[model samples]
Target: MGSISDETVEENADAPTYVPSLPVPNVQELVKEDPLQVPDRYVRDQDDILQVNDMSWLSSEIPIIDLSLLSKGDKEELNKLDLACKEWGFFQVVNHGVAKKVLQDMKDATTEFFELPLEEKNKYAMPPDDIQGYGHAYVVSEDQTLDWSDALILVVYPAQYRKLKFWPSTPKGYKDIIEAYSKGVKDVGVELLRSFSTIMGMDQDALLGLHEELVQALRVNYYPECSRPDQVLGISPHSDTSTITILMQEHDKHGLQIKHNGGWVPVKPIPDALVVNVGDVIEILSNGKYKSIEHRAVTNESKERISYASFLVPRDDVEIEPLDHLVDSQSTQKMYKKVVYGEYLRSSMKRRMEGKAHTQMAKVET
Candidate 1:
């Protein structure tokens, strides 16, 4: 589908603005209540929660197959991997060859960056315009109330881009460590994309060529130890806007949740495994074959949680429309605008800052 510009709706002009309040409950008080009891506002029914717990049934359903096996050009295995990509946009990748030490260092560096004092964090807080740094939800505008979490965002692609311009100057080694991690993650992202291409029944070089100048970014999220973990969520439900997201989780923190068959499923972290999810772009490219799942994170009662997400997106110059090969007489082609990814990102940021609903914005024209 092509992108479409949003048509302004006057009815929303009178709606009350939502400003999020940080709920600070005493640790002792939280332990008294059910550690998993979400606040009334965030309370999801047992059925919904059970769906999350039912992930085991889908085990062997979603394989954490090794990509290294496919590099040998095994046609049968490659075909299976392709089916997995089309049917399940999510996968657990092991033996993809990212160094364990590097991954650990990346996690440590992220924690160190967020642990810096608030004032130091504020230096890199996203500007009202760019919306690319540490900040509370709805910092620029009030759409939905703020989510309970803090994040450090950096853009790292095209090889010649600037390092995060706004970051804490403390923790002397933070910058160097993060930069190294970013480079490593970028390399991994490229390799994974190549694998995805083969799975899509296309030559690896063909897909890489199409996305030669892809836009890649990293978001380091910190969910502070919450006294009332059940009262609030680390992040609200939303679909990622990139092509794919590769996530690394810190030890002992459980917060990532995924949506499957109309339910939220917790994605328990596996040591040394990177969590991968498809994004809107992939859904478009695959012509409804692969889904861009909706997922969110929930907080923990005692331990603080941290996660690193590497987003791989198309270059700003690339036109985002459904691939022609994905359409046929049996599948009607949907028309979206042929907008540039950069414009879409900028517009989306502006809409978010204005406290406007993301869905209200125009769809990307094909």
Candidate 2:
């Protein structure tokens, strides 16, 4: 453990390009105070509580992709990747080349971070006018329903974009572990993008060329156990707005569920495998060939859950739209309108999470 100094946080209080989220109560401490009587604000209605009532859809599992096979140019693996994107829009990645020790180190550091005293953790709290820090995100108003979690949101890639002032200075090597894990995950993301381009019958650079740079950010969610778990959601159902989201479940606990075929299916965690899912950007660039799945986190009745989601996006200024290959003259219509990544991101940050609502902003209705 290391001591936290306020100097760095004070110096960068007004970080540029940040979208502000309204301050929210810290769920972890609140639960410690009383796990039973959840505040009215955290209590959600039945519809919100159970987005999909039917669970018969759990019979099918999301696709699992082997990176080693894909790297070998295996035709069968390629076909599987293509089908996974177009159909399920979600998959688990194995043999991804990220070392087990690195992953475990990150998980341990994060667990230690959340275990710190509230006041110590508060040293990295999200500023009143910026969302990139340790706190709830997308809380745009006081009346909005709250999720039963606390999150640390940070931009990790494009190294220049990182605001280290918001990063934890404790647990000794927290920063280094996060950097190593992020790099490994980023390599996977770029490779997946290449696979997607190849699937579309274009060269490897086809999709990668759409943006000037690949941006990566991370959101570490800490879902505390709730006594009235049925009444509170860990996170609201929403599709990621990035090009792709790579998720790692740190605690080996089940909380992630994706909406599938009009019902919700719990995502079973495969040890050492990371979950990857298409996002709105891919859906738009694919001209709707690839769909972004709607998913949410459910609270556990007894155990806590922690997950890290790495969001890979394009450069903020790029104009994102259906690719030329997907929107050929023979095509019936272009399914999505063009959007500037920065504008789309700002819009998403300024509002609360709504199921697939951010993705809808880019749709070109027929």
Candidate 3:
């Protein structure tokens, strides 16, 4: 299962690039007009939940790894992480070494921003066809099923790409808090990817070297209390398009759910832990050895849950594929076509706008 790269042509360093996609109009504005109830426009008829016949899948637990142990290169811890990557595709980390103050302030910042008056918050409303700023992403069509949440989305990495207008300048120290939190998570993400290289028996720097021009996005999701929690989803069921994602959520509220064996399972919150997920990009990079799990968020009846997700992605111009070293006909087959991040982004926006799984477009046929 390890040597699948020979069959395909050696990858070219230069890949074609495409213009990035625009996002839908800010749906958060709509939320302010009618905050208490789910609007007809946001109500979805299609069931996003995966219905299951066998109830046993709920017993499958999401693994928790200690990042401190991973940093020390402990073989046993690395083995546990490898299993988590191959089996669950998601895990939680305690003692990850990110400052507790940074985590708390980041959460506080998300809450205070959402608590602002709608008019105040709308100053940085996402532009049409743009994915950044405060707005609902993928609300591309009038008929799309809207999520039951408000989000402050912004690009965090490569300082040049950041749009300060949307960064919430009104908060006394919002930008500083966000900057520290973003840097902390990025440090952790890089280490996590390094460990993945070891797990796959590749050069210690194989994956990180391929993705030097790193990109990241900060998605602060606010899931408000819904009168009909059962009738609406906070976010739809879909796999992440990025290479990896690190998430922080409040310990008391549980809204994230992962689809497992045709059933939805809730992700319990653990204090001071970051939830890491292997994304679709990583699946392709590993020749499908690691997978991107389908997950979604459900609404709460009483408490509002705020989740801070830092998406780790490569430059859109970078080419993504199964690394040559990871492929072999024995087990690790090249299951996807080489993908340019810009093209992937455009397709993702189009599919999400139309409410479809965009990641499928990158799959290679046997």
Candidate 4:
């Protein structure tokens, strides 16, 4: 086990004060009333939620990377990847070699599972005070306004930690499809982690070595069609807690939005492409060179959006921080304090649940 660094703080072992109450209502089970009416509970506290319907932003440039070339030792591709990581902080990967059939199967299975009755779906309901199974994530209070989306979360790595109880047995091939999809994602993520290291002027295995016990959690988010898409959020604006996240959205509706330049911009959906983003841990590990963008999901009046996010996280007890080589080689100062992955995650959860700034909670004083 790693010791907590002096620069970090973990009061009461950094456990969250607010524990979530279980058996919460699944948002997808609720009725999506009318095209112009939004439930008061789903209304966001913030007034601005991009009430306009504009596709002009899609015409603007966005990073859509081709991973097949990057894996073949193309220097230009490496440079592009580095730029996208440092500047865009988000990109879409295509031609990644994962079969289109596998992707589709996973999406089909997710849809079928969420489409089940409330009782059948709640069979995998999350335990009280935890956010690991079916239901809306981070529902800590009775009055806490909930997101307009329902999600199924599964931990699918490090065989020992697998909770078979929550694993679904429907759709015949659900388990196999997920296994294959996860393997493909892991292959891509491992390559990207190595690429990230190469771009940082460190040994290729420097960062990869930290993944001896890689933990991957999958969240299948179903953003049901909302009556008033202009007024409510499918998901709130927040950064992910993983080191990296691989996301796949249903091809038809594009609802993912990222904060940029001074406004929220949409990430257009490209068929068979996987969206990747730098997460908070990577920002700390890269010594603030890479960024974790704040992004959210918007609902649509007529279309529903389903997305799968594969989150790659470190073991809770593992030490997560910037590499010695990164700070030394670049002559850059360590801009954040090193903390155990578990503690930092708890702090982040509390901040997100209470509507606070979770991303910058660990910035070190320069």
Report lDDT (CA) for all predictions.
Answer: 0.62, 0.86, 0.77, 0.75
Q: Would you estimate the TM-scores of all the predictions? A: 0.78, 0.94, 0.88, 0.88
| Clash counts for the predictions, in order | 20, 0, 10, 0
Alpha-carbon shift of residue 14 in model 2 (angstroms): 13
| lDDT of candidate 3 over 1-366, digit per residue (tens) | 321121232222342222233344344454556657677756766444435332334534789898889988999999999999888888998888899999999888778888888788888777664667777776656667678877888887876666665677656678878888999999999889889889988867777788767788889998877767777888887888888999997988888887666677777889899999988789888888888888788888776789999999888778988878788778666788999877787778665532226867778877
Q: Per-residue CA lDDT of candidate 1, range 84-203, in tens? A: 666666777777677787888777766776666566667776654443556643343433434556777766565344334554445665665666676766776777777777766678
Q: How well does candidate 2 match the true structure in TM-score terms?
A: 0.94
Winner by lDDT between candidate 4 and candidate 1: 4
Error of 2 at 76 (Å): 0.6
- Cα deviation in Å at residue 355, candidate 3? 9.0
The alpha-carbon deviation from the true structure for residue 248 of candidate 1, after best TM-score superposition, in angstroms, is 0.5
Which scores greater on TM-score, model 2 or model 4?
Answer: 2
- Most TM-score-accurate candidate: 2
| Candidate 4 lDDT tens digits, 1-366 | 231121122222322222344345556656533445566878875554653334446425668777888777679988998898887789999988889999999988888887777788788776666666677666555676678888887777764555554666665667667778988898888888888778888777766678667788888888888876766788887888888999988777888887666567788888899999998888888888888887788888777789899999888887877867668745677877778887888777654343227755667765
Candidate 4 stretches with Cα past 4 Å from truth are 1-23, 32-37, 46-60, 328-331, 353-356
Candidate 2 least-lDDT 10 residues: 1-10
